[model samples]
Target: MTSAAENILERPETARRTRLQELWLLFKENRLAILGLVIFVLFFSTAVVGVILTSGEDPVFDPALIRLQEKLLPPLARPNLETLAQGEAPRLGVYLFGTDDL
Candidate 1:
């Protein structure tokens, strides 16, 4: 057999790359893909951080915990003296999209 034919028949001993790794390599070559990746990461990180920071006892689950005086509070609405006296804070846990019912 010719040397070229012998070389073509030989298998390399190095480990093969994974499909995901290969895809990532290809994805990194595109500028738009990199931008999209960054946006996705930022959104994901924001969601994760919001969840972590918002961790607390949820009052919506318990009917008894609901205060009629505090119902239907607007977003970023400052707590009144009466509400504060009853141990309520303004905004009620960073309502990013706002909440009609508190």
Candidate 2:
């Protein structure tokens, strides 16, 4: 007669089947918990992919354009006289929802 431990060790497929059966039983007993886990994983994957895709390029500096008049300006601040006289809308990088404003 074979021992119980020997029988389990002899069949690797049987061990996998046993584990799957236990998981199925647990899922059946806690359906909502399993569903919540699936939803969380889906949202986490979407957020990670979005961050990877939407990052912007680095800004280049122009030493000639760096005048004392424009020093210490915050981002998306009002445009200087040159930009206004040229009739060009101030380009504040991408807005979250794609509006002209910052």
Candidate 3:
């Protein structure tokens, strides 16, 4: 029994290599899956690197020093304070996404 076990352990590594080669062949045959995998890896790397490089910065602290008056103003939309005061038709721009109304 020990000799049989030793023989099994001493067998050639072809089975493992064959499986790896088969996997490689399959991966090569699936071009779309390979492209998707590459894209996913790239995006993941970019996100990881971006986070690592930007982690030291304080998000709350605006480096541009925007005034409080400018805070919460909607992007691409002008303030409608005057319209609100007059109760008239408010002129608003198309905010692609909802802006932080200051």
Candidate 4:
């Protein structure tokens, strides 16, 4: 029931698919493209985790929670009085990688 134009359009479909496959193989061989993909995956994972932790009323990671005294302490340092008084103590009890500047 199809016309001549439809027949012509259908004929090259396989050739087009083959060409796309060849193009993809060629693209994968490029080192720069591979590096870009790795960087993309690294940042993409962190972004997803950040979104999940920072969502809703009680965030898993609160960006505004700052204890000035705890800022420079090394990882696993005990919670001193200044940081304790802030009442926003890190739930883990020790900073995994320590706190950075607010």
lDDT of 1 by residue, 1-102 (tens): 698888877957688899999998999899999999899999999888767655657542233344555557666655455554544443344333433553
Query: What lDDT would each prediction earn against the true structure?
Result: 0.62, 0.54, 0.57, 0.78
Ranking by lDDT: 4, 1, 3, 2
Flag the better candidate by lDDT, 2 or 4: 4
Error of 2 at 38 (Å): 2.5
Candidate 4: where is the Cα deviation over 4 Å? 1-15, 18-22, 81-87
| Cα lDDT of model 2 by residue, 46-91, tens digit | 8876665545462232222333444555655564666333423334
**Cα deviation of 45, candidate 2, in Å:** 1.7
TM-score of decoy 2:
0.33
**Which prediction has more favorable lDDT, 1 or 2?**
1
Number of clashes in model 1? 0
Q: What digit string (tens of lDDT, one per residue) describes model 3 on residues 9-91?
A: 99886655578888989999999989999999999998886676436554322233323433465546554454334422223
Specify the highest-lDDT model's number.
Answer: 4
lDDT of 4 at 57: 87
lDDT of 4 by residue, 4-93 (tens): 878898775554457888888998999999899899999999999889887878997687777776678887876776636655777777
Identify the leading candidate in terms of TM-score: 4
Q: Higher TM-score: candidate 1 or 4?
A: 4
Model 3 CA lDDT for position 29: 96
Scored against the true structure, residue 26 in model 4 reaches a CA lDDT of: 90
